[model samples]
Every structure is written in C-alpha cells, then in structure tokens.
Target: MIDTLLILHLNDSHSRIFPFGPWTNDNKRFYPSVIRFAYITDSLKSLYPKHLFFHAGDYSSGDFPFNTSVGKIDLKILKLLGVSAIALGNHEFDAGPDSLYNALLSENIYLLSANMDTTSHPLKTRIRPYEIFNISSKKICVLGLTTTEFNDINPYQKPIKFKDPIQIAQIYQDTFNNLNCYLKIILSHLGAYVDTLLAKSTNYHLIIGGHSHTRIDTIWKVKNSNNDTTYIVQAYEHFKVVGKILWNLTNNKLIDYKLIDVLNSPNISQYMIDTLNNIKSQIYARFGNVYDDSIKSLDNPISNSPDSIGCLDIPTGNLVADAMRFQTNADFAVIETDVLVYPLYKGKVTSDDIFQVMPYGFDNQNAYNSRIYKITMKGSDMYNVLGFAQLIRGSVPIVQVSG
Candidate 1:
C-alpha cells in the first residue's frame, strides 16, 4: 500500500511563546507566535490526517512564562499542537529531576530518550527509548537521543548520566530494522554535529535534531556504509520557521521526500487565537506589570554584546559589573555573563528589557530580594576568586569585573 505522511518538526524553541518578528536578518514579516504555529499545524492536519508533529527539545526556560509557570503553558501548547513525540533537551533538566518529573506528569505526550540513564531518576519509567506509530497499518518508529551536555547544564547536585547517543541510535536502528518498520526517525537533541555523525553511522530514514540552535533550511543527506541515505533536518530556533517534510511510502519503502518551510501562515484559527490570548493574560497576571510609567521611560540603550562564541568582554561584562558596583557600592563587583540571557536590543531599553536579561534570582516572589552580602575577604582570598574567574574564561563561568 502506498501512503503519504507529512512530518512537521521544530527544535530549540527556547520558551518564545509570544509572537515576535523573525529571528534572522530577513524581510520576512511573519510574526512567529505559538498561536500562529498551532493554527497552521491544525489546518495542515485537517488536510493531512496522517501527519505528525515532533519537538527536538529545549522546550522550557529562557522566558518568564516558562520559568514562572514551570512548563505548564508549554505543555498545553504542545498538547494543543498535537505533538506526537518529543526528545528531552539539556535545558529540560535545568530545574533538576524533580521539576522535570512534575512537568512530565502533567504532559501526556510521548517523551522519547534512548541515551539518558534515568535508572536513578524519577522519570525512569515514564520516558521510553522509542515509540511506534501505526498509521494506515504502516509501522513508523521514532527513537530519541538527547545531548550529553545535560551533565554540565543540569544541577551539579543531581547528576543525570547520559550514554553515547550515536551508539544508542545504531543499536535502535538494528532493533527497529528487525521490527520491519516502514520508516525509522531519530528525534535527537544532540546538536547538528553529532546528528551528522549519527547519520553517517546509521541507516535511519531521518534524524530530526536540535541543540546548537543551527538553522538548517535545507536537509543534509548523508550516506551510510551500505550507501543508504539518511536525511538530517533542523529548523533553526524559535517558532519562526516550521520544518515540513512530505514522505511518500510505497510497499514499506520511502519512495520520495520533500522538505519545505511553512512560514507564519495567515489562516489563524479562532480557538488558537483565544488560547494565546488567555495565555498572555495568565502570564501578565502571574508576573504582574514589569514596570511603571517612570521606569518605562528608562530607555537608556547600552552598547554591549557578547562575542559570537558567547564570551563577553568589557562592554557587556563591565557594564553589568558597574551596575552592581554602583547599586551596592561594593569595593569591587564581578558579574558572570552566563547569568545574562538576551542582550539589550538596539532601540529604547526599558526596565522590562533589562529584567528579561537577568530574570532569575534567589527568590521568584521578590526578584530584587536576591541576597547581597558585603564580605571582607583577605587579599589572598580576593586574588584567588579573580584567578578562578580567569580560569573559566571563554566558558559559562567567565565573569565581568568592576572596581
């Protein structure tokens, strides 16, 4: 029997729920909103009932709604969008295993991860290695592989060991081949580099990948040892672009494949628009107003940005350190650039914009109540702290300084 399947894929959408202009420097006027995405996907699914939606990972964090709501809003969006399956991203572990467990408990969608050693974690039984979909009596299997970088990105106190993703993918490919599945797809959060390696190693039909936030507009077709081709696709970051691929299967073999971009389509469903409106209202209620009229006009634009490799220098780091030093009148101040999320936009910068840069603090109820103690450290101790910061340069531990 010959059948067609439309696969809608997205990745590394770091909690950008609100609709905004495109991320790249293009003239595309499409406002990338979750509502728009849902509307488009729903319309397509109506036309193609044999379609599937998959998220490659990094679903939570990076936004106030994600942080404050603890992934509830994202889960709703995923469920509404009819996400068939999702791979775990390193950021999914940002809040530790307990929080991840709570998030998963609320989300009924299939969570696939083959390499994560959750034997000691709460999600051991909940997460499956792979999932099989029988559409039109045709067997379609999907395996998941998350990045090993979770070890570094997660909490130090709670260690979630990760096995080799490439090896796991190979093992699963053999297992699924024995099952005689028509199509085998690997939903991986192992980044593009590792996904490429996996494609070269395995004979899987497709690898939908995430991490590194690379925008691969075109599919990368890699041939395995047997000369069988494996397609790897990643749709940049954010919900600006949805990766669409049509798979034509005949007699249990994929005959033809076409990858296309489904930009923000204008046909928005009223239900989705209402859902988005409710989400916005809930977010505003939860966080309250960010700034008053007085603080709204504090639009002092700062010319500071981290390097392409995410290493911040004087302009970015020093400015933050100077602010800390000025606020507390400390002898010296050191601010880590890792804590800084998005950079200041070129236009007017309000208090809301600055808060978005550094939203996380010790206390969520009172973000400004992060404890700041003035400690009298010995000259040797101070020197050691600065020395340690220097050692972590070019990495997350890299800090900016002021005196």
Candidate 2:
C-alpha cells in the first residue's frame, strides 16, 4: 500500500469564532465542530507525520471581531492551527500593504502569491509567488495566485502589480516539470471559475481555491491532455467549517482522495468545545455590556422578511455613499452594502453595528474622488472581478435588497 499524503484545507473564514443564531442555533453542536477541526489537525500531524496545511485566502476584513483585531487574533489562531502556506485574497489588502506585512511578520507563516508584486512594500522578500515544500521524499510544488482586481480596489498602493494567473501557473508548471515534483498544487485565491479554467489547461493535480467562500466537497475533474484529475475544494467562511483533503499517493501519483466537512457533523471532541467556549466567554466578558446596550434588534428582520428586499438599510447606504461623495468631491459615490455586512443583526442596530459594517474603514478618499462608476464588462473580466462576490453570496446566502 502506498503512503497517503494529507493536505488540510481551510478558506474564507471571515473571523467567525462563534455561530450566529441566523446561521446555526446549536452552539452545543457548533463548538464541537470547531474543536473537532483542532483535533483533526493534531491527529493528522501524528498520523500522516508528513502532512501539509494550506489556506486559500481572505483571512481578514470580514466579521467584526476579526477586523477589530486587525488580523492579529486571526493570525494567532491560524498559527495555533498550524497553517503552512496561504495565498493572498483581495480582502487581504483591505488594510493596505504595510498592515498586511506587519501582520504576516507577526504570524511568520509562508505567504504565497505568484501574481502579486510586493517589491514596493516591506513584504517584498517575504511574499513570494510560489514555494516548494519537501515532505519526506515527496517534492510538493505550490504556487499562489491572487486576483488582478486588486488594481481596481487598491490603486493608491501603486507599484504592486498582478500577473495573469494562467500565465503565472504556466511558469510554475514548467518549473515543476524540470524539478519533477511528486505533486503539483496551486494555492489559488482567484475564485472558482478561474481555478476551473486553469485546471483544464494545466497539469496540476489540485487547485485549492478561495475568494468565493464556497463549500465544495466533490472533486472537479477538468478535461485536458494529461487527463490529470484536479481536485478543487473550499471551506465556507467564518471558521465555522474546516475542509479536509486526504490524498492517497503512490510513487508520487495520486490514486484516490476524499474531501470531508468538519463543521456539520454530529460528533465533536470535548477538548475543542471547551477551548471555543472559553474563547467566546472571554469575548463576551470584554464586550458583552457594550454589545448588549448597542446591538439592538431591528423593528423588522432584514433577512428572510417579506418586507426586506435585502440586508441593507437604504438610509444608511445613502448616508455612507453621500459621505464618500462629499469627501471625494466627485460627481457620484457608490458603496456596496454587501462589502460592509458584518457585526450584523436581523433587528435594531447600534455602535457595534457600525464597527461590523465598516470594519475596513473608509480610508480610500481617492476612490471617492476618482469618479468610480460601474460598467458592465465581458463575461471573462466580470467573472474575474465580481465572481468572488457572487460566490460569497452563494455560500452564505444572505438576502439583501437594493434600490
């Protein structure tokens, strides 16, 4: 029997340490799910003894608690979980390069992104396009690809450039061919469609994806010359779930694999449950009073309500958009309410509401003044830019109304 290589995958966890009532009611059930994930990591480390861990991206700038910690707390958790390499998601740049660099340094994890140019930033040396991991006798070639749309969302941080993902993958593929690695995988933060397209064209055996926060368990078999099977997997956001990929490798070739969902299970470990509960209690103790007073229920529920078109406040949107318009001195300002939907509630709102809503901060004065307008693009460009947003909606399925 050939030795199996296990690659533990986690993605799109937008800082959800505890379950929301709207999402899942059983903290009894949810806490164990998290604990199970932690236990799995420890078990794999002992069982495989040659296991690797990879994260797709979007580690920061989503939920209120996560943004409040400025990614520091998340990094601590990831380090504790033993993440080896991670790709850069678009939200990773929400704080700009300096903040990201500082945070990355604190965690000291391998940051990979083939398309990103960190030369101008302090992370130039630390942030590489690809990294190779030698586990036992197997050479696992891993390449990272970030969304090029960073140019559109973060223009102020000039000098940072993104290469075409497919093109970069080709470069890494050629390098892998020369080195003759046991397995070739792409840690892609380029969304699902691009991962599919790249898998079809390349000889890669797996494409671990992020940016969409998709919960895909089945393997995506791409059609190509090599007839090589490409496995695509993503864990739904908020640390609510953990994705497990078990690969049976025989003489450097994958014979079989399995992707398991660690979140929605009935059986969970006691140790992990206790750890999670302790963390939650600490959080409540620090902010419980403030959250209770400020976090008021809505007169009407926004999600799943007949009166609600979507989970956004028309008045709040107008207020925020107008603020952008005034600050930028532009003809118009457009804000996507979906982008700031965190620390959210189905009822009355408060100060914590604003923090959760605008955790990324309104620092892009240039975006306001630059006359940002939405233009419909061809399917490909649109897929590249807005694809992740749609994917997130699909995975979480939060209803929002727009006028």
**TM-score for each candidate, following the candidate numbering:** 0.82, 0.74
- Tens-digit lDDT string for candidate 1 (358-394): 5433233442313445667787898898787777663
Clashes of each: 0, 13
In candidate 1, stretches whose alpha carbon ends up further than 4 angstroms from where it belongs are 21-31, 251-264, 291-294, 297-317, 324-341, 346-352, 358-399
lDDT of 2 by residue, 1-403 (tens): 7677878888776555433323234312223334556766676678877688888987766444454445666677777778888887777666566667777787675578887754656767668877788876778888989888767557534556787888878887888889987788999998888888888888888888988777776666776437856777766665666666667666665554455555545555566557556655655664463233445556643332222554334445555567666766665455665554543455545444444454453244331112345444565764454456656765342222222
RMSD of 1: 4.5
lDDT of model 1 at position 192: 92
Compared with the true structure, the alpha-carbon lDDT of candidate 1 equals 0.71
Which candidate number would show the highest TM-score if scored against the true structure? 1
Task: Look at candidate 1 and tell me the lDDT of residue 337.
Answer: 62
Give the Cα error of residue 133 in candidate 1, in Å.
Answer: 0.5
Model 1 residue 233 lDDT score: 88
The lDDT of each candidate is: 0.71, 0.65
